[model samples]
Target: MKNKIKLCILLLFSLSISAQKSNKPSTFERYLQTKELVNVQLIDSSIRADLKYATTDNFAKTILYDTLFNIYAHPVAAEKLAKAQKYLKELNPELSLLVYDAVRPLSVQKKMYKVVQNTKYAAYVANPSRTGLHNYGMAIDLTICDNKGQPLDMGTSFDFFGRAAGINKEAELVAEGILTKQQVKNRNLLRKVMTRAGFLTIRGEWWHFNAVSLSEAKRLYKIIE
Candidate 1:
């Protein structure tokens, strides 16, 4: 009976060790919290510099826009962003990632009004109507730039919500010269960038992408920050 008891205790200890291993922080998580890369620029640098106080739920502080209204998840988001950036760089060296939004600090909601003013897409921009992937800091919306850093015209502006924004249709129109070819080329380039990053485009928006591995994104990130 004593020998049986000892075996049972050993079994329990083994299970405990396994559980501990499973719960340990991930390498991505550690790297997210510590390592910083020179090539990966924070698109929100101006927002972070401007606010200087707000932080995302995930602890990524605001850099450009008012985080009081839009807090961002920490640079932990840098992992996926880096992956996306790599794809963008390859597609067109001139195109880089610029975060239109990230974490929202409740305090900045008042200031947010000014930012969204008179914009056709303001409703989508102002509040978290749905769980913004940006809230998770796992999503990015970017535009392409020219050698001079000027944004090329995609069929619609970055957050445009209209029929003209249809990716496939616009691609065809641009091909036919119904729309300026550069606009179509720009859209195709953006699509290629997301595809290379392992992302698939949704039917609705040219500017948005869900990381290819939706489950992985959910597992790797939380919504708060």
Candidate 2:
């Protein structure tokens, strides 16, 4: 009877140790371990980050992210960004990529949709139901900055939600004098570097780019929440 009682105590102690180990934090238990998302800053500190969604300065006019800092992306996407940063440095040592948004959670997407839904701008913000590339950590909203960390004017500001912000409208805007040739050149420079690094730009937003297709993102990764 005493042996059986001692065995029961040992079993309980083993289970307790197992639980403690499971709860213990390890060096590998980092944001990168999330499988689909990797903290870009962890991989490359040179990349500038603004993260407008983390502040009320965005089109939503509200803070969307739970944390006030840190940008995350799919490992594949982050690798391409690192390459793009390297290319940018080669082209102009003073220039660096500044990120505005990355790896938006589905909860934040719902917040964005709530504000733009039923409006003409609704098309710019993807519906939460279908889940966009950003929800899967595969999209980025970014721009280029100089050594002083000042963003180069890309014709229209990020999240302008107008025809002026469209990549397709650059020529028309330049011809109309609304956007100078220099501004278009700056935008194209950003595109050149990003495309060289395997990112695809969207038609309506100059600041937006996808590391992978929507179909591929949906098929290959789970949405971040």
Per-residue lDDT tens digits of candidate 1, residues 69-151? Answer: 22234354545556666776666666665445443323244344445567654564546434445445555455556555566
CA error at residue 31 for candidate 2, angstroms: 6.5
Among these predictions, the greatest TM-score belongs to: 2
Count backbone clashes in candidate 1. 20
Candidate 1 C-alpha RMSD relative to the actual structure: 17.0
Candidate 1, after superposition: displacement of residue 191 in Å?
Answer: 1.7
The lDDT leader among the candidates is 2
lDDT of 2 by residue, 1-225 (tens): 999999999998786556434543223224435655777877988999988987788877777763435667899999999999999999999999999998877877898899877777777777889888988889999999998889998888999977788888788898888889988999999999999999999998999999999888777778877
RMSD after CA superposition, every candidate: 17.0, 11.0
